[model samples]
Target chain A: MTETLKKFVAGLELDTRMLGMIGALVILWLSFNMFTDGRFITPRNIFNLSVQTASVAVMATGMVFVIVTRHIDLSVGSLLGLIGMLMGTLQVHILPQFLGLEHPLIWVITIVAGVAVGVIVGAAQGWVIGYLAVPSFIVTLGGLLMYRGAAWWVTTGQTVAPLDSNFRLLGGGAEGTLGEGLSWLVGIIATIAAVVMMVLSRRQKNSHGFKLKPLWAEFTLGGIVIALILGFVTVMNSYPLPKGAVRRIYEARGEEIPQFAVMHGIAIPVVIVFVIAIIMTIIARRTRFGRYVFATGGNPEAAELSGINTKLLTVKVFALMGALTAIAAVIASARLGSVGNDLGTLDELRVIAAAVIGGTALAGGIGTIYGALLGALIMQSLQSGMAMVGVDAPLQSIVVGFVLVLAVYLDIAYRRRAGQ
Target chain B: MTHANAAHPLVEMRDIHVSFGGIKAVDHVSIDVYPGEVVGLLGHNGAGKSTLIKVLSGAYKRDAGEIFINGEKVEIHNPRDARAHNIETIYQTLALADNLDAASNLFLGREITNPLGFVNDDAMEAETRKIMGKLNPNFKKFADPVSALSGGQRQSVAIARAVYFDARILIMDEPTAALGPHETQMVADLIKQLKKAGIGIFLISHDIHDVLDLCDRASVMKNGKLVGTVNVDDVTDDDLLSMIILGKKPGEETITS
Candidate 1:
């Protein structure tokens, strides 16, 4: 590579794994777009894809920390199921009996109850793994079965349904999307925030008496970020709804078709994903806790000798995983407008696959939250694209499995070349 | 070159004994290191030098012994307790987080933080650069993880971490074992600087040249038992060798203890 190209890549401050993940995502999107005859890249499909990718992406962020710590949580999917059932019970049955369905308190109480249950469950499992010295794989594997069985027992294999309107809104139903104008404003604010963060970090690096990246490089990065954010907002703002829905009111009054704004912008789940991703990235990059996590993962004995409480860090990572799983449970159940005994079945594998595809090593000590998010998006895109192309469901699974293995194999090869 | 009077020993290990599965790995060994002194611990592999030092560094719980730091009895149940008393150990393995950058590894368990409780990476990198400037001026690759670093550079990072933490007592296990000649000289310069600052160091080594050149005193162990500690100027290299091989000190006749 040329010196300038090397400088540009270095100045971006992204490791090769992140760049690889992004490259793979772009290629996947383009290939899917071709397969779907341009439909995969359409605004509506993209918006729906973003919504579909949110839950797995959220859990994948937490899974990065878990897997980085050289552990796994096989129970997240079943845990999501159990938590979703609890959320259903709280919102659909139990809460209405005490507080009226329309009362705003019901929402707050149900959400809190769901999250609290997740935390307690997660922490208990973590404690068993950390303090009791049980291997994490066996413990969580047991939890997988227990939580799944409990989800079924909670309603005797019955489905819980008809969640409140506010809950459904959180899942990106018609009422859940931000309008175009608000989305544009949000886009601008986010761009400004990105630029400000960049400037502040560069200044901080300068103050640290280190070599600074060239100003042109920084400006180029800032420009790309702003363009991407604005472009995304533009796409989301232009999703054309069905003509029938737009003209129904006019047709009812025997009138001409009126220009109608589409029912789309940024869905609540997408916003949730973005916010969670940002927070998780910061925690993984900027916090002392994050450093300890990486250290423990890289060399546990070294970390312990350095005086870090690796056991507590393990518990905390798992608890965070559980908490995110709960959030995923809420969004998933809300999206379907009901909770089933089999809710979130097989989701744990998907989340783990996403993290691995994003360059998180099973051997531990390396991963990025954004990479995992993009990994989740890539998988979602492939699924949605294949479905649109009329591929069989079983064939889709085989392809995804092969892609996952290929991604990991390529990552290992890249690392070997880099001599990691 | 010795301040042998009045200044108390920085750390004193008395009759320390540690066992594994009913076998004495470190037999009743007593050692003391004074401030501004470099005590070379010479022994063969599995001669118990590492285990003996591990007792003081709290890497192992002594089956029988007492440890005193600065003339006060201190109980060290773990590495944290050793760190609490400013005792730092650099294992032969270097014990660095390989996936972390030099700054992150330098400040690994104890990171400098901003008011928001976030690890101040900039401040850490700055401090790391400043310290490396003092210890090893040629170290410039702060952005790369320590795993990508050369052996000499990795050794420099480990040395810098212990030195930066203001460790009053330092234990180095075969620090130069994996290093090149130039890097070994760099470490010698570091030991001199640290010595001038009154930091006591226990230098464990199998290299007689390193021990003779860098240490003020030499103590040899055989089969988990201390043979004797001799002033470098008072004993020839042959005498140290005899003490190590035969577990018998020079000028001793009909004496076995």
Candidate 2:
């Protein structure tokens, strides 16, 4: 009876760990708001924070899988750095001289090469771990140093500057993925899609004779999510920078500005992360490949005896990690607008912290994409908040460290209390 | 009673040899199991019975051996190869992924999927329910991970997995060792049902009483080699024990228990 009540209160059925992490994120946000005297919770700051969290959040999503399979990759930071520098060279120097800056083929080739390099690097590492029988720790640890060295070697420790304008926009510029009206349209469409999916899934579960949330509970969830989406659109629409092109003309004429809103929508990288999260969630929840991954992580001996190719799974996981690292590289480079020797310095620690904080088991066989993203958000929020409050960098690190430990400790205690 | 199956054993393992780091785990042991027959492998600990059966289940590669199934020579290289031959083993450990639910464990490698390859979880769960209904009617918690289940219940899930996959040759390592008396009876009935369906079973057990109650033929092994295989009706439990303990055939020595 108590369990049913609690489930009803939650409105949406989710693992308590996921709920707790989300709750922690909320608490973290509120505390930051209090610390910064309401300056931190503004739509602009939240928007910026979301964009900034994209790189680590994206990598954290993939890291959840790697860690779930009872393996670790310490080379992501270096891989990100190397991929960023390689893209930088191609976009700013190599391609411009050959194909010219405005040529459409240049961006296409550079982007394709970037993804190819990531896959090849990942596949090679995966092959070594899966087929050649090298332990992932030793393999990726070697990758850490080798890739970092390669990053330095690529441009001889020089910073590659002024990436393409199109690429620049993806890193979170004044321009947006969608205009103001289109943003509202997408938001409404997404909310409708969510409701439709809920209905279909509920029908499927009912057909399977599974107990389901009551109609009121379902309605409450749909209402909350739709409200949140519309709210987010409202906030983005209020950013008010590129006001209809007429505002810019009026300003040029030294005339009074008209009271109108022009929206830049959400950042492209943020949208990319959203799409990636959706695809990953479906894969994790609905696909055979995903089931095999969890099974292999849960028990390698059982998985192998059940005819799952565990060694090959290990390799594929690393390859996917590499592919995601390359994607992160694109975002990081675009955001920085310059590729430095230390492009992704010490970033592996951040995503590892995020993944674990989101309740991914160090012991393996458990993780979620949303959990890791929320974990990333919490981490970035603390950093961004502390910086806004003029906290010393060293002190911020100490606080962040304590927060990560505290979050994980609380999660462990909760699981124990719940007898998980 | 079928003359067709009496012509040849469903499975024949000849002179199986497996070594782990120069230690002969299974050495020159041979066994044959006929269809619709329960062949009890009786041995003390370290007698290489489990190791010997593992070679047929494809968990371990025999250094020297030729396995013939259904009157044809076939190579058993890995678990996948063994599965292709419809051979399944229910290990003493149950070999379940504890984090996955019973249905997931039941369909670990072979999952039902839609056109896009997304697993049809509903179909899998329904199938699991149908099979578990036959194997263990009292089973209720289909969504709970195998780790959360009791020893007997876990055994049911493992058995359901084997039977659902259409396995013709079943190898069970101490299937009733951890089960209670009531649960053990359930397995006994299940064995009878499988026998009725003409499935061949290799029941590896240290329980002499169980062997007497269930086995049609008893093969005793000692020190990685087979002592002898005898008809259960032709010998007493004491004779089987002597074969197990003294590595002698039944007629050679009898304890007269």
Candidate 3:
């Protein structure tokens, strides 16, 4: 028992970005509730916050990869805008003639088309950056302007609106009378993912003839996370809907009525963001490609000597970032039900800030996908809390900017201390 | 004493010449290293010691000459080819990534992977411990990055990597230039251990004391030309200095040393 206790302490001391992010998130939640007279913890407000943060949070996941490799893609925001515009244009102008499909099929095609555009554009930029050895800053900076201009040219500086009903459902859709079911699903999936990851890593270590972490530590952490997720779902489910709020479905005239509900249990954007975050985290942590990413970031010259094709790795990273930007664009456009030239204006700064604040070094080397997501959440929470207190946009911007600078300073300070 | 004649020389270079642009960096220099023997290459800075080693390690291609390993002539046009011939080089800078641990540095370019294809850290750590035990039993490298290690420990890691890869000919450039007394003694012990293992080592140094202590035969160069090779036991530090300064035999009285 004494040895087990000692092992438990060691496990707690392990260096992990996930635990840090969780700690920060808890602090942010408590502070927001304390300062806003408990208004910030409302079910409606929480759901709204999830939807609002999903777009940028998803974008930052890809941005983490680019930043870790000591490269920047200033073109991400513009790529998002261009992808959104392409989806909108295809749904409005080309879907009818391109295919006779309707509803769900057309929605699927539009999303795929958006993703394709993102991939093509990303590959073009990656080729220049990797093959020509052009500085990523210059290539991506040029891409930022060019892609934004392309978006404007595609739409002629006009907003495309009145998206098909099916497309709208993708952003804010309802599935049945299972209120809070989707949120519960997300919570369960995340907990399961966390548990599976821990088990697989342990197994991998043991198979490779390495020491394994104490079983109790792993189980205790996993159990606590699962319990917390269940508790969150219960709290969210218990909140009573405001009086006269529209029900999602109503039985009338011997037919079902699709009521426009604000909380459709879970926002599609939130689910999309969570799923993407999980996938990216797996890819970055558990694969050979992930090792190459870390190696390239840590020391490019050493990586080259180690026989890693550093150029291919760099270009692939950029391409992956592009794909992520497109996923974010899809979620954004689906939520807004329209796309315009200014869809992703100034979003590049937020994405980069999210990665930096999450502890990804701007100098290239160490980072985690979860860190970027947590960084985005911290930004989102600050923005949402300030808005709840009736703070102006400019003031909120200034506060976030200060937080970003503070996070970077803290990162540098931590590294310096570690160096010593 | 007769072992040097009984066993074939580990490495031999014939009329090795390397030039950059129009100037010859290493002009017609020839040297040989016998198994289990230390050979010192003495020269001033820019006097072609480094250039000659670079050609042997295939870091630089020779404009002319042939290299033989164990009496079999071979072409080493690149570092990979040099490794194929069991020739390893320890450069002045060490070329080690400071952030990596000793084990990672040991198998930097080539790592042991498990069935899952991830780097097998445990296997590597175990192998590192085993190798350190044999090479430098006093080395304590557990969980420490090379950056945090002492200068002697870092050198141990570099030498261990070369030796672990089965290098028959070890080329060390200025191995003890920056070491203190104690650290220098540690490296000297390591050199004796390598000599016992029957591994031929090329010790390049400007310190006459190190050459006299560790080398069996000392070869001096002046202006990219070989002066002569002398058995370390038969020559004095003054004799080696005369060869370097005047490019002549010791006791000719032409150069003051």
Candidate 4:
């Protein structure tokens, strides 16, 4: 039976560690659902959880690269706060003076400026850590303090409110959804992409005369993926828009409200997370830059000797981290409909925890984008689950900390036993 | 050796000097390698042999020197520059990215990529299989990271990397130090094969037997300075050892060939 189970897992090409993590997530969700008397597993709660996880999840994907290269970015939270404040000011105070109120370009210009500043700041920190030969810990820790102070200085400790309506859609609230039809369209397209990718990869392997997984296994894996994707779409599509939101949407469109309740399909921020995950996965698995990143992390001396410009690569990785943090800032501040000094405060810890819990080793040279996404989800679930069960915030944090350490410990033990 | 030397030497590191913090690690070392010849660099641990070779391999910049490739004055400021000139080095540490599979390590700097610039890992694996099949037919762990491989297997990965690139000047630093007798013999055969292909090789080894068995010439270093270069046919193991240990050349520096 054990042999058969092993074969089954191998056939499906499933990572046992990932499977274990998925199992833990399922158990956590189910237990929480019971504790909250089924409230925790509802479509509304799950949707909120996904949206809440988006900012950290987005940052976590970049953190995989940062940590896989055996570095840390403790300044991500502060960087996000700074960028968010800067973008907030641009949208409210500056862009209006230049382009008039409610101009279409205000949001676009704000986002581009935020991301640009993010990359510049990130690359600057990277330059110091790379070319200057400073330890990443010391450098980013300084950035943590510096950027936070800078963020406060941006608005002089005042909260920026009443952001542009369009910008707020990125934050994934009642108005930040794709609606039912668009969500199904995205789900269908994603499923088709997944299938095509698998078939193309299989064909490529075949051309090289490499061993292929069994046809049944391929079908089974495909089935599982399709089920998961469609299932998520269905769940999102099931959650009806609140009566007030439905009326507002119709009134804005200058149409009478429909008789049927409209579903608030996938949240926009959640879609952003999915898109980032896909792009980051492709970058990590298929690009030479990604290959070099892993190689440099694996052995700095070997990578340098192999003619890889590792110092420059460090700068690029950190720059990528900065850009991602900017995206997170967009989601975060938009979600709140305002930007404050406390925006993304302590988010560095959450992002790092998400990456570590997702199986990124601190020692470097090993991580996955999907692992981080799932890790973020798991973390959010734990916190919200405890909250639903009426646990105090302090207790929730304590439990979350224990889980993080325990998960890493368990992952280490698992890897040791697996002899990898 | 005379016939091989009749052609222009493939690599010449003239008056190479390197120092660290005022300490001369390699003081005025000059060496030349002819195509299809193996020149063994003999020295004790701190004798500057590795440092001199590192300059040629582009691991270190010379404090003062000139390097010529195929009789052309060349600049080699980095490992990429060295590789651009088809110079490959298998260091004492093997220099394999431990977390990457053998194929990834083999084609690291020069990966086989699609037109889109994405790494074609399958193509690289196929190429690695073809090469490893030739080098070590028993090597089956192409899918696992190099870290998971045994010492000899890891050695083969490093060797495969250097050889696969069609290097004109190959530097092997104690290639067989981690291998068993059988694997050592395998490397010896590989060296002979590489030599027959007209590759110029710099073999750095403390093993007198390895030098005597494989090298056509030997250059010994002591106190960051060259003792002298000698024809392997004219020197016994004792003569080479004395040159390494006592910083003295043998009785006569004659090329009988």
Report lDDT (CA) for all predictions.
0.88, 0.87, 0.78, 0.93
Residue pairs in collision within model 3: none
Ranking by lDDT: 4, 1, 2, 3
Q: What is every candidate's alpha-carbon RMSD to the true fold?
A: 3.0, 3.1, 5.1, 2.1
Clash count, predicted structure 4: 0
Error of 2 at B255 (Å): 15
Per-residue lDDT tens digits for candidate 4, residues A291-356, read: 999998899899999999999999999999999999999999999999999999999999999999
Off by over 4 Å in 4: B2-5, B252-257
Per residue, candidate 3 scores C-alpha lDDT tens digits across B96-167 of 666567887787656787787767666788789899988678888657667788887888787788778987
Off by over 4 Å in 1: A1-16, A240-259, B1-3, B252-257
Candidate 2 ranges beyond 4 A from true positions? A1-7, A10-12, A242-259, B1-5, B253-257
In the range A243-286, model 2's lDDT, one tens digit per residue, is 55547646766998777665567778888888888888887889
Error of 1 at B84 (Å): 2.3
Q: What's the DockQ for every one of the candidates?
A: 0.77, 0.77, 0.22, 0.86
lDDT per residue, candidate 1, A261-325, as tens digits? Answer: 65578888889999999999989988988898899999998998888888888889899999999
Q: Write the per-residue lDDT of candidate 1 for residues B59-163, one digit (tens) a residue.
A: 788999899888889999888899989998888999999999999999987899999899998898889999999888999999898999999899999999998
Fnat for each predicted structure, in order: 0.90, 0.79, 0.16, 0.90
> For model 4, what is the error of residue A332's alpha carbon versus the real structure, in angstroms, after optimal superposition?
0.3
- Better-scoring candidate (TM-score), 1 or 4: 4
Docking category for candidate 1? medium
